[model samples]
Target: MPKVPKWVADVLENVFSGFNRKVIVAEINHLHPFIKTIKFRGDLSGVNFKPGQAISIRVNETNFRNYTPSFWDSENGVFEVIFHLHGNGPGSSYIDGLELDDLVNIVLPRGLDLYKKEYEYHFFFGDETTIGLFKSLKQVIEENGQNYIGILELNEDTMHYELKTRYGLDIVSSSINKAQNAISFLQNLPDRVWELWQNGSFYLMGNGRSIQNFRKALKEKGVNSRNIRTQPYWVEGKIGL
Candidate 1:
């Protein structure tokens, strides 16, 4: 939900809390200055999670934020989510201040249909906010023995995060204009690389402007719009997306 009235949000929260699951924060790790990974333990026996799905948590009485789980073990009743604590608003502040054993009510995972197994090759393009989603997708793709390539725009300090190394995503510093930097990087790729990925599926998330620019570049390269999927996590000057 996007900035609803306080009374309306309260009513929705009451209804949502009926079926929402309460999870305890089990552990927290700071992967970078602004990146934190949190593990939550709870009874998730019947939860049906799909790659690229996000769980919504009420950050405040009138605001809710969605985050993608990086990994989960239903049998063990544990799941983990990586959060980029840009700290511009309540969601980041709430997540950053969470302490061990704190109870959090989270709505079940739900999101757009992002992953299509029918495609042999998958391409991902996004920034720090999309890391968790990419991580979840990478797990399923590797399990299916599918090929994938990804590029992420991250802060220079975050470039050394172990998760990025483990996921093997190409990282570009955010010091430059994000959308232009990403588009330039894609345009500079060799012809052979484009040949291999031209027919693949593309998943674009994170900044709305970046997705728009990247999508336009892909189309100009003769990639079909049908092959691209986009979910903007945020936009410049917007509180939530």
Candidate 2:
């Protein structure tokens, strides 16, 4: 299929304007030196959002970006999205420039369904961009009486502390190594956790290269390809995925 051009995207945005929800920025929290969380309030009724799904936000006339909600409150019409301000791209600038009461347009959440009930245990891997998805999964896993373990590789040292203190996510853990060191981290998975790989559902996201490396390492460890799901949000030297 031919790639759609920017002009077509703009036209489609206008044609489907009715599907867009108007949201207000309710709050902002700088979780780390490189990460920020934005709270949004809008009419979210009638939308069935899955744990790992993401919503596309219209950042400007010709730019749209996908963001996974950290949590959703259908009754209250509120949710949160975490952003990694690693570059000066349009998405980063738009998120950074947001203030309380600022209005934005976002489409409904849709993406891969990672919260599988068939599996007894799940193992999640990602970087800063995976934080929101991790948060979404943790809640559903606990509610469903299932087990899950998250190993996130973040470049910022403060991310680990913030995820624990600010977010109170005890089930998810983190490493200080940059995303490039994901292979080494995956290779050194503790012997105690190796037993969980059997019959485990693996979810990998974030940096594309790192996700590929982790997926390969998991396969080398005898994990079935059917048990692994990956979504590469960004790639090295690439604008987006």
Candidate 3:
């Protein structure tokens, strides 16, 4: 839940406790100055998770935040989420202060229609907040022998290399005018690549304004609306989205 009244949040928490799972922090890896990966272990036998799904965790008495798991092993009851520590908000501060063995209650993964197996090729576009979602999708896409490519806007160019080397992803980066730059990159792709991806599924996520601009660019290029999936994690000057 976004920012709600404390009483309402408490009531909802009580009602949803049946679907909650208590997870203990197993590991924490600081991948960059602004990014970290957290692994949690819990009993998740009944929790069904699909690629691109997210779990909500309360960061404070009246606020909850959703995060996508970058990796999951249901049999081992383990999952990892990559967090982008931007700004000093409740979610960021809460995650930043997490320590080993810290216990947290997270709602079971919620399904989303972001993945389509029918498409042979998948395209992803977003910024730092999207890394986890893309990583989750990449696992399934690779297992199914499907192809995926993406672009991420990062604050530092070195992060591109780190992500590519660490995750084995076909991702490029843009450091300025992210949305417009990404559109230009896509539009200028070689004809063969363009043809192969034009009908493929596109998952646009992360910054809200960037998503809007990217979506418009895709539509103008004749991409089918049904082929584009968008989930804006946050917008400028907004608390949560």
Candidate 4:
């Protein structure tokens, strides 16, 4: 999706019901050189959002991207989204260009069902793109008194601030090493991590190859396929998933 210029978004907002939202950029934080957070405020009264749901933003007349909310307050009509500005495409440029007080149009939230309250133990695995989902999961898991663990693969520059000190997730962060396949790193994870993998329902998101490798390891340890759930957010060489 291409980035939508403000003038065109404003004109189309009046004609398309899907573009009815008028969100003001309340705050923006540069969490890292490659990661940023955006806070949006508006009349979000009619919106029905869930922990894992994502909103599609019109970057341009023909381009758009889906992003999950890291946090939100329905009563206050505000939400925050953490973006991984990889600087590889138009979407990155669009997000990088956004400033405080900017207005934009976004579609209503939509995504796969990720949470199952019946499960007493939960496991989450993903990369940087999975941070928002992890944040949301942590809140729900704590609120419901469920046991959960997260394992993430992030580039060295973003891993510490994201999973370690910031969110304080009980996670195993493997920094990406240029000489090795990231998925291969999963096979050498601590024995205890493998032990826990067999005892809970797994939610795997992020890089397709990494998810496949992790899921394969779980299955080899006798975890039923039914015990695992996944949504591949992106694939190498593929635009989106």
RMSD of 3: 1.9
lDDT-better candidate, 3 vs 4: 3
lDDT of each: 0.86, 0.77, 0.86, 0.75
Give candidate 2's error at residue 184 in angstroms: 3.3
What is the lDDT, from 0 to 100, of the residue 57 in candidate 3?
A: 91
lDDT of 2: 0.77
User: Which is better, 3 or 4, measured by TM-score?
Assistant: 3
- Over the stretch 171-201, how does candidate 1's per-residue lDDT look in tens digits? 7776445578777788998999889988999
Per-residue C-alpha lDDT of model 3 across residues 146-192, encoded as one tens digit per residue: 99888776555345447767665445455445487788788888889
Superior by lDDT: candidate 1 or candidate 2: 1
lDDT of 2 by residue, 4-117 (tens): 467987787789887788999999999776789989998999888888888887676567788888898877899999888878887888898999999988887887777877
TM-score of each predicted structure versus truth? 0.93, 0.87, 0.94, 0.83
Cα lDDT over the full model 1: 0.86
The true-versus-predicted C-alpha distance at residue 79 of model 3, in Å, is: 0.7
Off by over 4 Å in 4: 1-20, 170-197
Name the TM-score of candidate 4. Answer: 0.83
